[model samples]
Target chain A: MPAVIPTDSVGLVHPQTVDFPEPLTLECGRSLPGYTLAYETYGTLNAARSNAILVCHALSGDHHAAGYHSVDDRKPGWWETMIGPGKPIDSNRFFIVCSNFIGSCRGSTGPASIDPATGEPWGLNFPMVTVRDWVRTQAALADRLGIAQWAAVVGGSLGGMQVLEWAMLYPERLRHAVVIAAAPRLTAQNIAFNEVCRQAIMTDPDFHEGRYYAHGTKPRRGLALARMIGHITYLSDDAMRAKFGRDTRNGKAFSFGFDVDFEVESYLRYQGSRFVEQFDANSYLYITKALDYFDPAAAYGGDLAAAFAPIRASVLVISFSTDWRFSPERSREIVQALYRAGREVAYAEIEAAHGHDSFLLPVPQYLAVMSAYLERIAQESGR
Target chain B: MPAVIPTDSVGLVHPQTVDFPEPLTLECGRSLPGYTLAYETYGTLNAARSNAILVCHALSGDHHAAGYHSVDDRKPGWWETMIGPGKPIDSNRFFIVCSNFIGSCRGSTGPASIDPATGEPWGLNFPMVTVRDWVRTQAALADRLGIAQWAAVVGGSLGGMQVLEWAMLYPERLRHAVVIAAAPRLTAQNIAFNEVCRQAIMTDPDFHEGRYYAHGTKPRRGLALARMIGHITYLSDDAMRAKFGRDTRNGKAFSFGFDVDFEVESYLRYQGSRFVEQFDANSYLYITKALDYFDPAAAYGGDLAAAFAPIRASVLVISFSTDWRFSPERSREIVQALYRAGREVAYAEIEAAHGHDSFLLPVPQYLAVMSAYLERIAQESGR
Candidate 1:
């Protein structure tokens, strides 16, 4: 384990890459061969390399977990609150690694990746990916980094799915696991939301059976519509009311014509339009399917507890109060399974109204709980 | 008034049509010059023509309020519960009439209707219409039917808007009015929902900017997406949970791909697809804008009480307990204004889980209340 202290002048670190191979061949019977994984690492790796903390991201998140780049100009990573100096997953105490998932379009091999054989964008021909496949890829990356084990693996929502997978697949490799605002499998409603988005994208005339790029057309409108629908679920009714209750966009009177009307409309439109610039619609299709197919307990003969039987990691499971898409009830299910599996665990349902995105919000209680947990683990690890 | 107890063969017959041309001309500017109104009557028209009743329809609703078409299998009018032989708006006594509003894709003149001079579809050339314009057209139809005044004018939601418009524009035309689950004007949220739908239609590449008829392409995807968005609002969260939960369509396991994962997805897809078959995208744009622009009170100097100043009608307003879109508070606002205007009125907020569409659903209390109110009015009129 590394000494739990920070150095004043490490300056900025650059993101690096590692090679990983697909775990199991696709149902289509073809192995994906070797693939490149993009990741960013902060802090230092100890001689023992046991103080590593893996960070998983949500559906649209990237590997930039914290800090800013002079060139990129993007905001300091999505989870800067709990990942920086003296923070919850303090860089001074652990080597933090955040990797873009394989099925993601963010510099990863996804539906938009080039096909080795066809010599063109994979498009719809990309092989289906499951959560297990994603975890396996991460494991390969850990191996290349000489990280035989990790102090903890933490993630929220879809990221939490990866954390659960880590506990199930390589229990001996991690000392603690944190899963937040996630489910054991795709719920019917979750599936419904994904399906509607897919239908919206696939049915767009511009989609052209996913050969949109060949025809020099983009399913931007369809993708935008999908984002709008998904954005609604990402928020709670109360949040929406507080954010934009009956607030007109342009004027008070109705235009009696086709135009943006409410502030919320303008907000959603901006979200959808802006998203299309950096996102690939094909990647959305593939990744959404990966989430829909996730079932950590299915491989364990229907016993979720049995699935975590091998894990030796103490677990910290967190959920948000207002995440309708992945509610607290879902988090409780994971906690119950971990308990039944006899794993050492801590559970907390944070009081936050930010829906599934609460984990990223600046909630004081969340930080206090995480800081205490990380410090306690570092003391036990003994650098 | 005609004898209340005596009517021989044809239940009630007072169908009439009149010319309507006032205010501003349509976008086509071919002054409506001489408008031809079409309407059907129910009960016998009293000698004084004061026993006539008016029924308004929602966005896609038509004038067929009851009974099956002699030669068609499309079923009875959308609202058959309160408009039949012994029902609330009893055809046995009150002469009821329902007419499709202008800008509707139905038999009424709309974007799909041919221009008188150009002999081509009005298409984008149809002048934008306000809720007030539709009401004016309906009032003209009432005059042609020899109806100097109505026993009552009744409607729900958008239909309710028409009822309020009637009270404002032609107070002497009705002795009483019933408004159900409606607002005085479009709130910011209401306008937002409408704007998204309009954008969905206009952005569709197949829409061809409202001239796709010659291209053999229809903006079906946009229309479907619009309907899907609308469907979400029409339903309550509790209703969605009770009806769809997380149940997948015909499977216990996710297909691990971009297929319908939940029952809700199938339901929404079915709704959206079905809507496209029956509705014109342009008409959707026009009608939704009408609803969004409605503000009878605002047009009357921001005082709802003043708006009802000319209304001689005794009013009855009803609201469903679960209607979030046009909540009971909105109905209360209308009732308060009528009361402030010194108008005779009855108000009821019925308990139902069906939300804003509850008026269109089966509810014993709603029907019972209507029956009691009508009988009381009939006795007072001595038709």
Candidate 2:
């Protein structure tokens, strides 16, 4: 077994890949023959190895959760504001592990990965994965690091879904679980948005039935459209109004042409264009499917409380006021279920203006509440 | 001048096309060399021509506001629910005129129409139009029909914008104005949604710079995607949840493939596919641009009250409870402005689950309110 490697860099983290020799059985009843998980670690594991904290990433997130991948990188990790030496998670006190999920394009075995059987990209051939599958894979990674139990598991959005799964499936493995801006299951409207995005990509001529890798072409236009749609949903109406208003680009009147006129339009276009460079279309399809298929209550005979009955970990669920995508009401559903199951759960519906993307933003109240919650967990675990 | 042709068949309307040989100048300072307006009229015009009411249609709506074009037609006119004999806008008591806007595809001079100069479709060459421009054209049509003034000008959504414009631009021409599910200006969020829809169509390779007609192909996929996005926004979250609550298609579990599994997805796909057959892509681009550019308050330096100051017509503004697209608050902006202008305005926020489309649906309360208001207008005008 490879020993856990500790990094000395203050605000930088490096990803390491670990290969699992055993074939992993997926929820769809398919097996992936030997897979590798790409992960990054911050700080050092204590002598007792109980100070480890696993961090889960959202749909477009990756292993770099807290630090700069390169010194000259234009932007830090997606959640840099909440991680690092003195941040809320406090890397100086607790060891942090963030991994790129199996179906992601960022240094993971996903649709972009080559299939040894056909000597081509997996694409649509990749097995469908569930939140439980991701949690189980994370558990295996934790075991390999010689951690008997993690002090806490924390995540937001899809990452938060993984946190909920970890609490339910491996109750004794973690002492605390934090789920933020997540839902028990996607609503019909949520699924509708995801389907439209899938349609956008699938209908693109360049997609080539997900075999675009073989043709050396990508569905950039379709992927950009999907990203633009997502960007609109991620922003609250108030936030958009405050940021862009009816402000025109370049302070000009309407050109009366098909040019980008409003600042919001230009911003969305940039978001769509920039996203295509970093994301894979097929990976997007797979992950969104995983999100849509996640219905914890379904496995428990439509009883959400029953699903949380076995959860032994102390749970913290956080939601934003303006997150219409996964509204605060959705968070209340999870919190109420935990309460109904006789579990210790803490929930905070933070007032925010950034909508679903608020979890990744640095809101002062949100940061303070997160810090307090982590402190309580640290005190309870005697870390 | 053509005589006012009244059809003897009840609940039936035949569209009449009138060509204007002279150039009609647009708000953007560009002129269409020659244009034709396609319109349909129901009921009989009184000897005084004072009972004539103009019914404006929203985006994707046509001149067929009541009755079927043919007996075998599968669907009645878009607003047939509210505009037939003995109905709310009662064709039995009022003369209703509905015309396809100049930028629409249904028998109107639009991007799909041929440009005599080029001997091809106008495509992107169609001049941009505003709500004010549409009202001016309608005024010209009324002149040609020997109807000096309208009894009431009624509309919903984008049509409502035109109704408001009529009250301000030609207050003496219309006695009553009914604005439903409309805003004084497009919000940043509204513009953002429109921008995404436009991007979806424009980015399509088949779009060919909006000249897809010349290329012997249409941007069906892109247009479909745009329509799907629009469909989502048009329906409220509660409406979607009630209609399709994660109900899978074909009574099967997850398909584990990209095929439509959720009923909502299937419905959106159907809407997208069906819209492509009846709608033109360049016309979509032009109309959405017009919608985004519509800001009645902008011309008055953001003083909505000032915009309504010259309005002599009595105003009725209606909003729906679950309409997130044009929220009740947006409707309130128009009503409050009318109040500040000391205009006779009646406001009603109907409890509806249909979102923006509630105005067109046969909601009992909506119908009752509309019927009573029109009765008051009729009594006042003594028609």
Candidate 3:
């Protein structure tokens, strides 16, 4: 048997932990205990604690928002392109706090976390979580850090869902809210994508109904497959075409068979395969479901206006025109809802071909928008 | 062990084989004797042979074009919507010949087919095939059926690739060509999508370098994931939103964990799960490669006009306006090529929100345009 060469390189890059005890009541009526959040902090909190910014991570995001890790040579994290020392979310100016969400596998209390009672990983036993639950956990973390208020609460996509939740659940905690490429509710299309991914993870024979760890057979293939599908949605067709055309592999004519005929095939394969090294399939199911169940408007009698009624924070909603997953129309829905609530809101649907990932990419226009918004927020807060 | 549930009752329908062999030589300098083809004939062949129309199937399509078996309630076939007694192809007037392509799993000489020497499934040892191979095989079948000429060859998407190939490879045999939602060459974007799907299939742990049959694991999850990805491309974002738009199954509330949340997710899951039962993963890889490698213009030099130089058939090129996979621009390229070839060509880029699958839907404009084109072909053939 070939020795299983562990790509231990993954997850070793950053080590973070946040310990909380006992059961945390989730909005869905489920109770989760031993709630420990793994996170990373960059820059420094100021004396007034007003410069603290809560940066929410997306579906597959993590705590290493910027800067190099001592354990690994790889760059800071997945959003390294947009969240560095002098980047838009400038680590130099603000104390950026990013925590791995409750259901994430990155050292968070997720499906792979050990269950105290059973001495086994939680697997499907972990209580179902909502966007509100994730936001509440962040609040607990914030209170522990002596940050009574935030300069801004910002996120994109699923992270954007969290940002919206923060505004509704803890309006007094944030002076400004930046929701990028996110929606107040998961459109049926969003849910559909999530459902397919969950099904992909669960249907794998190795999934073993979420108990595959004991058998030493991880549902890596399923996780990878789900990631590949998600990757497609994250990119625009134009970008895919421009990046990897129909060029055949190996400087040889196409074998006319299924031999990884194009460069794109190899790239996706690498992405999917590498993802499974650190991600848990069951966590994929949990997080995707959390994203699907997020609907701030539902709590306010289907009136998004009512949901934002309590918010006093200045809102900055940024959407990418080409983001099909969470389109500009969805952002517009948020803008209209804020308007109805009489809340101070600013919205911009930027034109970009990068699709949903525009927020993470260093597109000059997106950076410019965020930089301006941050500058205005700082000025308004007297920072 | 859980028993493998066959998909959608289609597997219960017994298929008939059509033996077609010739001295086959490939562009890769490989030769094989006795290539067997499997096909199904619908409608009766008229005495004059002018009523014969060849129907080319898509990537995973088989010979069963229309009508369910009485014993099994499976939907007739994927293309059942467009081919029936009085439908667009008009079985009553035109004898329809639908063949399982050369590298397809449906009773064709593909990875799942038997090798006469070993008396076992060829598996990965199956020869790599091209669009030209499938076209040549169809041509051989026509010859055996005494179809000296076809009134028209019709197909959509990958099927359209075959239609174009028929017109190019043996123009004398075709009187009319109908290509729908297809391109002359596989753009980088098309290759990228297909490549990801191939990666998903190949990376399945059970895939075992394409020898999973012995392990009783068929890379079903991977193939299903691939289909899930492909299904997204087949529909426009607007269509997905309109059709599913966050509609949930079981209940209206979000599960707040990993599960199907929206109507679209459920639909995509259904598509992916249902696909794996009838389709082979290896076949998916081979067929997609063929599509990715299909560049008719490149075959006849960079000029598409030259590719159509030898094509004498009158062409009816159809495109769906919302089809991002094969956009209207691609159809225009074909029209321009045919016009430059001095061939009688009619073009229509239909306004439909259903994306590439619009051709198979009941779009009145699409139906009307195709109906008119068929009428013209029928008239020209002295029907």
Best by DockQ: 2
My TM-score estimates for the predictions, one after another, are: 0.83, 0.97, 0.89
Local distance difference test scores for all models: 0.77, 0.89, 0.78
Of 2 and 3, which scores higher on DockQ?
Answer: 2
**Candidate 1, residues B90-113: lDDT per residue as tens digits?**
887888888877777766777877
For residues B288-359, what per-residue lDDT tens digits would candidate 2 score against the true structure?
998999898887889999988999998999999999999999999999999999999999999999999899
Better of 2 and 3 by TM-score: 2
Interface alpha-carbon RMSD, every candidate: 3.6, 0.7, 2.6
TM-score quality measure for candidate 1: 0.83
List pairs with backbone clashes in candidate 1. Answer: A188-B246, B4-B383, B12-B43, B12-B44, B27-B127
Which tens-of-lDDT digit does each residue in B300-335 have in candidate 3? 558999988989888889999889889999999999
Question: Lowest lDDT 10-mer window, candidate 3 chain A?
Answer: A1-10
Question: Which pairs of residues collide in candidate 2?
Answer: none
Expressed as tens digits, the lDDT of each residue in A184-278 for candidate 3 is: 87766566666666766787778898999877888776787778767877877767667775666665666555656677777777888899997
Q: For candidate 2 chain B, which ten residues in a row score worst on lDDT?
A: B1-10
Question: Interface RMSD (Å) of model 3?
Answer: 2.6
lDDT of 2 at A257: 84
How well is each residue in A116-211 modelled by candidate 1, as lDDT tens digits? 888887788777777778888888889888998988899988899999889888988988998888888766557666776787789878888888
